[model samples]
Target chain A: MIEPFNVYAARLLPSQELFAQGHRACQGCGPALALRYLLKALGPETIVANATGCMEIISSSWPETAWGVPWIHVAFENAAAVASGVEAGSKALRRKGRIPDKKPTVVAIAGDGGTFDIGLQALSGALERGHDFIYLCYDNEAYMNTGIQRSSGTPFGAATTTSPAGSKSFGQKTWKKDLAAIGVAHHIPYVATASIAYPFDFVEKVKKAAAVEGPALIHVFAPCPTGWRTPSNLTVRLARLAVQTGMFPLYEVENGKYHMSVDLPFLKPLDDYLKPQGRYRHLTKDVIAVLKKGIDQRYNEILEKCEANHE
Target chain B: MAKAAPQSLRKGIEVSISMAEAAMQANVDVVAAYPITPQTHIVEHLSELVADGRLDAEFVPVESEHSAMSACCGSSASGARTYTATSSQGLALMHEILYIASALRLPIVMAVANRALSGPISIWNDHGDIMAERDTGWIQVFVENGQEAYDMTFHAFRVAEDHGVLLPYMINFDGFILSHVIEPIVYWSQELVDQYIGLYEPMLRLDTKNPITMGPVGIPDIYLETRKAHDFVLRESKATIVKAWDEMEKLVGRRYRPIETYKTDGARILLLTMGGVSETAMTAVDALREAGLPVGLVRIRLWRPFPFEELYEAVKDCEVLGVVDRCLSTGGPGGPVASEIKGALYHKDKRPKVVEFIAGIGGRDVRVEDFQDMAKKTLSVADGAPLPPFELVGVRE
Candidate 1:
């Protein structure tokens, strides 16, 4: 197995961490790593409008804040709307010669619960208006802040507190929502899916999204060891397995054209991605086969779209 | 039949259009809202103004009222003069952000065209909508007619952006009664509006150069202080609200007060009213006066911060205080306004005998006769008659 730190560290962007250390995030937190990479890519010239989630709680607990850049946390479901305001307001002020500095790169950050579920309307509204901002949905799969509850982003056969496995029923009966595809359907300028395990690719995508004129979305696959009931050290390993298994593919859509960035000649087995997490321990061999088939079909669809783009 | 040209209409201007003109005159930077009945005309005209060269602002047609307010919060936090127009259900939908806006101290001005709440759903005029948000901590004021609506829009922008008060303002006008009606209104000159509103200087905003965290979680140890500070500022903002009104009076030569009293001197009966009903109640007072009854009117202009002192000063000398409420509190002592009046006068040494009358609910028209009848019932209550908690006026039974 290739070591991620040794391969990615030599070519890292910078050592200045805008999402600084000494915060209260859980041990081996994957979303924190994603936030760290994003902030480092955007730098301090950014203003973040964050929704209420695990990041908001752990970052700014009181007089203490993990963020070195400007940040605001509104309600649970309006980060995109709030970011729209920030972008529009800055434009108005600059047009009137009120502010001396250039408009900051406005970013809206939210958890999967805030993005794929409650915050979808606000996100859709902001995107349709063509606000110059980037909406980053850090997908941790479940509602980790309020405990392990099943969200719309939760994969099928995963057991959350709300979607517990029983004698007659599976854990989560629904498939994971295709949030990135939904974002692409809005006809936005750019929409991409990246994971924290691949920091260089994630940072490059963030830089690309920031350069886009219209609205852009970057859906990040942020693993949660606490929520997934996995070992603390296996956080990065699980994220890599997810991508290598083709369960969470890395792709980008620019101007409605699909382009695959990380294509594997052979995807690892789905059981390698699921067997480590205690949340999926109850899955039967039959259920695993069905899940593998679903993942393969989705991967094939992405490949077909990529092929069509070239044609 | 061909529709008549707008300029050829009998009335000078529609209230909704004039309110939008006032927003343009104030030089608002952003207008974001969803379309709802009665309030739709205001936002539509604003969008037109933005589309034309008249107003240089961004008009966001948000998906819902929740997003409308959320966008306004962002704009205001970015240190812009943000405004939005909404009505009953729209206001209710934005209820969650109403508190957050005030707590964050974002000076966003919102025009709430007051209307009835749903079920037995109706889009007609009523106060039930705003009454439900009585505790959202936003500075709420009720206006009587189109002239007051136009004037209060200017005043709300100034007062909300005041350095001493940095709070969101809600300028409420009755739905259909004031929002849809065409009435002759005095449009202040753009110069006058510019002088009155001056420039909005935000205390804290989203700036890359100077970053500050806003709306952080208030833990148990510090949450109490946050609430106390919010209450202190809201209660103390009475002075700033009065100062803003006084400045408007100075600028326009028209007197305005938190609680405006009419013919209360040497009178024993006082009819308390708010919103558009005050105009009709004034006629009731005139008719009662001709009949040799010493009846008067107490019109409440400010709905929040209670305006306890001004309200008490108006009703202290009256023998009977007839409070008319358009929204029911249901299971409370009386309607919301009457109950608030009762609570305001509870600790006073010299207080009038209060009688509660609930009228104009679900957009039921409150005529001069209804005000007259309400005063008469209150006089009987003052003359040693049994006082029920409240009476529902205009009910078929």
Candidate 2:
């Protein structure tokens, strides 16, 4: 039996150490923490195909790797395909009495740039092939690597390199892509959006995704200090504000059923999630209000879907 | 009866094809490729074979050229002996992953109906596509006709999967010139194909039980060393390629050599080319010999590890060489072949003054007259006359 869910009380850290501390992860890098929590849920049986991103570079440097189990660092775009190969390869090897384990979890770690952009095709192929694997996209709202160039995942009205605030204003004119919705459209066994702000919800989704027999996608809203332009300490707080305000929802889809994991009692203003991030520092109040309009539209859409799915 | 048997009679149909029939006869697991002009006939025939249950294969109808190659990569990487084909822009679109295929050393083989690259969008014959991808680290083989195309695709699997190599190979044919043009070809029986090529049970795969990661990135410090390992394997695999060919000959009754020599016993001039263009040089060589000129023709098959030792022996008796590179290097001296031959012959005790020509770019059809002119130009260069420098043929713009 478990106690009534409280963020502090729900914290049940695992005994097995799949992610070692003192290994490089940016100060409060959400993806790194996501990795930590994901590993906790997965225990030591998971093998990760970590893509090239802020977390991969910082943690898996030359001297040593933060990963405690079997790991591979493939190129940026082929993480999903590589993971598919690993899953298929491992199965064949085991059946032939080559590898000892009868079953092992395979997961692919991709960033916003990798998942939303360059790696989309490979992801689609693996998912369509119905490969047994979990693909996690740590969305920090922009391409944090390469000094934060604008990616398709970057939010509207935010100033990025390509979408900078100029005389024309409205730094990024395009709204953030509804990646979780797109995942749902894949008709996968499981598709969910999880935020680091709610670690327990995120971990539950990870465990669910890992257990599914076919393709599963977990879209995690991560906060970056360098790209988000927030202070290191404010990363988690901002992520919390994001979910609390409904700007980033904590939800899941198990075989096409939509369910909200985090039930926020009181919603905060969207600016609380936006204010500390340097990526959106240039946005005027008017622009922020417009962004709120888009977020409202999205939340309404998600709510309607939840209603429709339940009915 | 002994007199009627004739001195040296070889039946044309008794010769095995190097391209089309190998996959069908081998009962390949998958054959997924888009039909781009010349290569279409090959796959069309292959498709019919699969439909007829002659070849046990999954002919996946993919979305595009990229998907076709991607499907091959996925299928082959998953322990299936997969086959695919492309030419020119189709090849160009797969450029990004071509490197990946070789780097992963996936042992996938593709037939390129060697069409020219686009811009003007010509659909004729040229080495434009294959030449551009020379350094892609694939064991590239240029066949003179349809026969070699069928043979090499079969041998490619053996040579590629030979744990010593484990690299992908590309068999190049001069698009419509050879790919669409067919001749009587002997089909190897399935049992013989099995005995010759052997069954490839993969040593590694993507499985659930023994989980392992494939295609990992090595950071800067180890990147160069990794590249060096790939290069060394590519070089060392040359011996294995030859050995595979010799074994193939015993079963199929046709032998293969990297560099082929024709009438060069005491020749002074050697005419060189690849693909269907070799026949043109052979014609020009006959004419040169008719005119009492000491000329020979050396046709190159493998272009990647570059049959250096074999080429040296082939051209050792020659003084002046005429090299035709259908694709442009675009910079430095002239065509790619001209530069390669120069490098190979640089330290020789007695070397030939190789005259290079860039011909048939963008599928400008090269005629027999062009070869005759090429041979005449070679003789002019040999005679120390002011050569029209190494010219780019059929250029009007």
Candidate 3:
């Protein structure tokens, strides 16, 4: 059984919103939950340069707004670029006394499609520049807005509109791109993988990302109930299972040292996580076994990294 | 009043020299670019300035045209008034990102050495690259000489970062023509530019104390609407462009208009062109007038907003138009500039029969004699076989 979201995450995320209300997001969208926790952890005085995604559309609709602080929706790929611009603009303004020195912290948010595909180059450029900004890539596995096309972030055996469960189909044939590893390779100030299943742990990673002065990236595994074809209420439960099963592990990299936030007692069967969601309903035993084998290999490697970080 | 002189000044200093010196005076914070042909001298001078500490800017040596703009984007977004230069193939490589920069509205300034696109990769002067990107939401200004390049580049920062028009801009200097060839340029002092355009006061920024969510996902119902709003703002922001130029005029004594005219005062034939080709086109008109042909020239300075009204009034009464286009429009009957020029004049009462000439493309050498050739070709068509305004000087089979 899953714990109630409000009761379980109270200590981690405050009731007050940094994202605020009135910004239009789907009822209980995973990205919103991710933003809620991220905002609480980072606190206020943070300016956001959002991209052209579901979050930007709903919150920034004219005459109605969801954000409590300063925010902008520049473009899909240029969120990191725009955030960097605002960061530079504010800093330069402060030095010249053109703007008050009390500048808000800049944070950029993008969905899986934007982060994993369209905006990848801009994100790479920002990280390379070592701009003091936090890039939050809320991975919902597929392009939820554009009618559930398979994004690079989508995992194997997951069914999407593009990767349909029709004749001669293996669902999404590729595994999710290891974005956290790529980010870590940049030797960024911070790189972390999180899930809404563990709100406190997620919040903590966000806090760590915010505190770092250089480029930081936080990837949150946000389950899409609509896109994943799962019941909305079972979102958190499925996400929590995703972690315990070693499918989407929760971990952080602190100054190049890898730290696993949760280490499971025993690996749960891959079928347990896959069976409930319609996205994975057509998965055959062979496909499940193959996925399990890859997951096991990757998990063992992660454990080796954890063991190596025995400080 | 004391310094202003004739439109033609004898063999002036190269525009690149004045551009380098203007940037030096502007006290730029960052100059990051990879040099392409035609744009080489501008960056060469910039690199030298940073090397000698003449300008206090972090000059990042980027690998490619994509990264050149990428570095500028990074540096500019970080609140630095960054500058970069590119043309032709280099500009094409930065094509996808040009839209990205404008949409993000980073307020970056790029000096574009306008060159033709490649099937044949010519490095000479043309407006193909810039014309292809006319609708990319960048505030583009075409300069005929080095003096304009010197003034426009500094003015770009003002127009781009203006609170009302927070858009990135590209100041186009014709490849080889203006970017390579030297001309007398009046260099303005930094004190005036600084006083005219103060430091950027960014509305939303990245800092530690305050945190907010940005760049969220926009769904279908709102996506089109949001894009429509952005499109509307870009088009309607023409007034802001004029206002910025006017304010800059107060500080520096020069002013800019969308469509610049030369002897259009009651002329029957009007020769039209953009960028450095305007000089050649004007020379053609002068020769035609010396032989008693009533011809004038109209130069399009601002490409974005199209300057339709100014163009309409400028060429309304003209009987014949020799519009030289540097870019091809595959789907349409002719090139991009020619098509727009014809379209803008279509609604006029005493409309000119516009003859589209595909000239100086792929960096092909366009001499002043080419315009004289083109003007003669245009008048012949106007006199008898004016087949509904179409392409003339194409590289035909």
Clash pairs of candidate 1?
A: none
**Residue by residue across A11-73, what tens digits does model 2's lDDT show?**
576756677787666787888888888888887777777777877777676556677766766
Stretches of model 1 off by over 4 angstroms after superposition: A1-11, B1-11
- Alpha-carbon deviation at B209 in model 2, angstroms: 5.2
User: If scored against the real structure, what TM-score would every candidate get?
Assistant: 0.97, 0.86, 0.86
* Native contacts recovered by model 3: 0.30
Tell me the tens digit of each residue's lDDT in model 2 across B1-397: 1121222232243112235567766556666566544445666777777788766666654434555665566556656676777888888877766877788777888888887777677787778777778888899888886667667877888888888888888888887777766466555555666766776666765443344445554679887987999899888889989998888776666788989988787777788888788887888778878888887889998887788999998887777888988887666678888889999999998888888888887767788778878877887777886656778887887
User: How far in Å is the alpha carbon of A70 misplaced in model 1?
Assistant: 1.6
- In order, the Cα lDDT scores of the candidates are 0.90, 0.76, 0.76
Model 1 steric clash total? 0
In model 2, state the lDDT of residue B397. 75
Write down the C-alpha DockQ for each prediction. Answer: 0.77, 0.22, 0.22
lDDT of 1 by residue, A114-160 (tens): 99999999999999999999999999999999998999999989999
Q: Across residues B1-397, which tens digit of lDDT does each residue of candidate 1 receive?
A: 1111222223478899999999998999988899854465889999999999799988888888998999999999999999999999889999999999999999899989888898788998889999999988889999998889988999999889998899899998999988988989877777677777888899888877788887777879888998898888999999999998888776676678999999898888899999999999999999999998888999999998789889988999998899999898878776889889988999988889888899998889999999999988888877889886788898998
* Fraction of native Cα contacts reproduced by each candidate: 0.72, 0.12, 0.30
Q: Give the TM-score of candidate 2.
A: 0.86
lDDT per residue (tens digit) for residues B1-397 in model 3:
2222332233367677667767666666666666654455878888898789777666655545665665455455555677777888888877776876676566778888887777676776777778778877788888887778888877787777887877888888887767767676665545566665666654544344343333344557666876787687777778988887787666556778889898777676677888887887888778887887666888999888678888888888777887888777767778788778877777767788877777877766677788887777766765786545555454656
Pick by DockQ: 2 or 3, better one: 3
Query: Which candidate ranks first by TM-score, i.e. highest?
Result: 1
